[model samples]
Target: MATKKTQILILPYPIQGHINPMLQFAKRLASKSRHLILTLLLPTSHARSISSHIGSINVQPISDGADQQGQQFQTAETYLQQFQRAVPGSLDDLIRLERGHDQPQPTILIYDSFFPWALDVAHSNGLAAAPFFTQTCSVSSVYFLFKEGRLSDEMELPHGIPRLEQRDLPSFIQDKENSAHLLELLVDQFSNLDEADYVFFNTFDKLENQMVEWMARQWQVLTVGPTIPSMYLDKCVKDDRSYGLNLFKPNRESCRDWLCERRASSVIYVSFGSMAILKQEQIEEIAKCLENLQTRFIWVVRETEMAKLPSEFVEWNLSSGLGLVVTWCNQLDILAHETVGCFVTHCGWNSVLEALCLGVPMVGVPNWSDQPTNAKFVEDVWKVGVRAKEDEDGIVKSMVLEKCVRAVLEGEKGEVVRRNAGKIKRWALEAVQLGGSSDNNIAKFVTGLALKD
Candidate 1:
């Protein structure tokens, strides 16, 4: 007779950027082992979006105090407080209920690093805990150093990591005074990490070998990512084209038609991920930059953000036949398109990985969080893209944005960026394929669990 399967539970912070990567990981874990049962536990608000698209992995809704309120919390701090207060009780109840069921009880708790409290819940219930980090290892290293009080005033970083000035640090640390709550949240990720069985980051080994090596010295670090759907990478997982969850329903058909009409490597694609709310002035500057380029472009201006765009910009673009200003679209689809040349992005980790995995060069206009650090690596370390410089007032002017885009899309610098992008893209693909670095790491995790069982 076959032995019982190991039951695993995953909990991600309830946001698009966080949920998608962790969900993809759940999918991959399920594919790797028949002896593992994976369940994704999301807050009620986020779990409502779960549907047929996510196969095999069970999705369960837990309370975050939003079910009764029937709306989002007004502030990040408030949301965190409520989620922390509510989720632990719900998780304990769920684990108890599962223990009474006929199936295997959850043996592992894979949680977002943001909620160190979950590790406590796991230990209380006799489960091994793993923390999933959705950011690059470089950014994580800075936070770890800061948390340990080892980061120096002069920014003397670890050996394998590049030296960074204050500005190159994650924005939360750079403006710690104004962003106290957020800075605390990020640094707190390391507080209970030592107790975790495994620490996972959504980055490949080749992309940050030194940083990953530095991080591994302290924890069971594993790099099992790109974490994008397999169809975009190795195609080993059948028909896995989408991330299976989106906060916004994309205008897929229109976006695909528009890109198909453009010439090869001739269109500019622009998007800032879900949460970034650019100031009206910054939006106008970006509008001006796109207008100045006079090339085919597709811009994703979320419905809420559309009001900040220059009045009649959409109408003007439509009439000029030079751009498509969409509310939201399948970003991976856009990046994978041959007509797309460069990505103008907010440099969110997920967006950066998608662009890198798809071999698209970028002009990074990072706004906040880990974006600035990711942008720095894009230009200085990866050499696969250029970061658009901002003016004294901390805004990227139209001319500066135009010049950055031009450098990535034309001339010798463009060639170098594209070539580097192509080279890294190949590495990204290899990392996810069978016997590749990331794949091996994933296999190790599965095998380790089996050996323990």
Candidate 2:
């Protein structure tokens, strides 16, 4: 008798952070057994760019309603309006086609919490649904708390996940500028979570133990992450080193050899992820500080943002040999390099997890979203990094940048930060190793998928 294969459908919000972790988890599940078939549902704008990278998964494009180029949409409101209207119908039709064909019926849909509409699609068709939250457990805990009607004018968390002021609320709920729909949507995502049979978080028990404990008191929350490449964690599968998901082409060829020239723990690696676009003055400030610090550094700046820099900045840095600047590089590969002494980041949770696993300390310059909360944890709770302070204009000037950089890379405080970062790194590795919490949870989830009728 032939055994039935578990068909898994993944639907990630079309963003780099959301896509990377989800794809990596897909690869992880595929590696578990040949009996699992992987499929990804992406918007038309992202489907082609990401399809070729995922080797084993079947890529299906769901209509997003605007031109394929995505030029017509500019703001989040406009894009969400289009996506919400387009996704359910396009996705329903695709499911019907799959059911009518030779393919196995999909058993479950794993989707990012931001796009709860996917849940309705799954339920309408009698498919099991799982909510895969891409946010750090700490940030999501804050959101969940707010959803419970526990948050009002009280900016400080009573349980103390991390010290957060009114300004540090989740980006959508923070200010007068936040859209009403966005705020309500975030709350509704948590409310809709009751429909999910299984919930997954892209975090590990050791990294955010308090937050994990808090959530477990209410519902079963599985911590199966720091969802990095399998190569870094279990080394369970061949050719699993890359997430195979990059919105921008990485320039690793230019960096591999250059990093070898620098001494150990001497270089500052700076990247603000794919979405942050710094003001021209902010770019100039960072460049001038990098030059004056006289430290070897590697900075990732897209070509589109070059105009924001001082004229000849690229040519001058190339000739000066003081640093290396490129459009992009394989971030994990670069961060894992021994020469990367410190990371200057926007404190995005994915970057934070990567750096923590690599034992790299940080100088956090938060821009928005959950970044401020992540930055606070980096500085206050973990003691693994220092948060760069911004002025009234919200600019982290050159001197402030230099001060924070030196504190993490050169000052007495840096010693403790490095030691603490190393400790966190060990804990992160332990969580994903054999018999670890994440390893056990992943195995349990896989088994549950096969058994669920």
Candidate 3:
């Protein structure tokens, strides 16, 4: 008799940052073993956006209640509530449907850590569960401590981790009064983690060795990432150039053309990611900073944020032939481009990993959530970039931004920064290559799953 094949269901929270990393991980799993079948489970609303482009991977679109009712009018909080309420039932139906078809029954469910409720669904359905954490191990460690109420005044910092002042913690923890909802969501990630069969972090052993080791002592933890596409790292997987999902259309041709005209390491790339909303004053400050630098640049100002730009900033900057403003562009392409020198970013984990992988120095203008902690590391721990200091009013002044950018682009410090960036890039490359730490972990995971089957 033939052996029963193993089917693994991978689910991400319905957002660009969450979906991209998990999707990349699914690709890695698929590439690692033919014995395992991979299925990406996305909310019906988000799946519609990238269903066509996610080639080769099976996507199972499960309803999120709000989608069936018309998501156009739902608030973020309401949408999440509905998703939590609706996904369990949708997941039950999906599992049953898959079994009824020619496909093998899903034996394992890999879910985003943000939704601990998925663990319950997995156990009740007789499937093993693993939680994939999208944040850095450092940030995740903080959340873990907070969840266990160990972040008190007397709590000692982990040995390998940096000392985190209150200001360096995720915004939700630092300002619980204003971010109670998000704090609740973050802390809830650890509620049922003890019951999970395994836990995965989107980081590599070399990058966070001490913390990864510490976390493993508590759970069946695995470090299986820097989960970007293969083409950018080791090129192990054929034609794997992108995460294969773009919620917003990218200005691919225009971005390429503009960057092509610039000299190597002469352009500044600016993007705040898909979700961060900069205040009008902050936007204007960044505009002034770019003008003061007087260098070739590409800025991604999403359409919703266009109104926040200072009047005539784009038109005048474009007329001067110093800047090109687009709604969105392929960030990896830009970061990997020879013309790009420094990345001004919101310090999102996805962007941070991409920059580290590409060896691009950064100027972090972190806005909220885990960004503050990420920025802290980018400047202090990694030594690959500088984080702009915000004034008392919490806006990075144009002068401060200019200094940070200049620090990364010129002078003796720039040389040191570039060296660190290059070193980190090599580590990232090795982490995903054949026989590397992440690759080994991925292979081990597949082996375990196949053995269980």
* Candidate 1 residue lDDT tens string, 1-453: 897798899999988999999989988888898888888898887777676337777888888878878877788678888888889999988888887898887888999999888899999988889999999888898888888888876766875567777767789988989899889898889888989999999999999998889889989999989999999999987667788888898999999998988899999999999989999989999999888899999999999998898876767787898999899999999999999999999999999999999999999999999999999999999998999888888899999999999999999999999999999999999999999999999999999888887
Pairs of colliding residues, candidate 1? none
Models sorted by lDDT, best on top: 1, 3, 2
Clash counts per candidate, in order, are 0, 0, 0
Q: Which regions of candidate 2 are displaced past 4 Å?
A: 67-71, 152-160, 179-181, 312-319
Q: Which wins on TM-score, candidate 2 or candidate 3?
A: 3
| Candidate 2 backbone collisions, by pair | none
What order do you get sorting by TM-score, best first? 1, 3, 2
Question: Would you estimate the TM-scores of all the predictions?
Answer: 0.97, 0.94, 0.97
Candidate lDDT values, in order = 0.90, 0.83, 0.89
- Candidate 3 local lDDT, 297-406, one digit each (tens): 89999999999988777777857989999999999999999999999999999999999999999999988999999999898988999989898889999999999999
Q: 1 or 3: which has the higher lDDT? A: 1
- Give per-model CA RMSD: 1.4, 2.0, 1.4
Score candidate 2 by lDDT. Answer: 0.83
lDDT of 2 by residue, 159-193 (tens): 54865676566666675366578777666668777
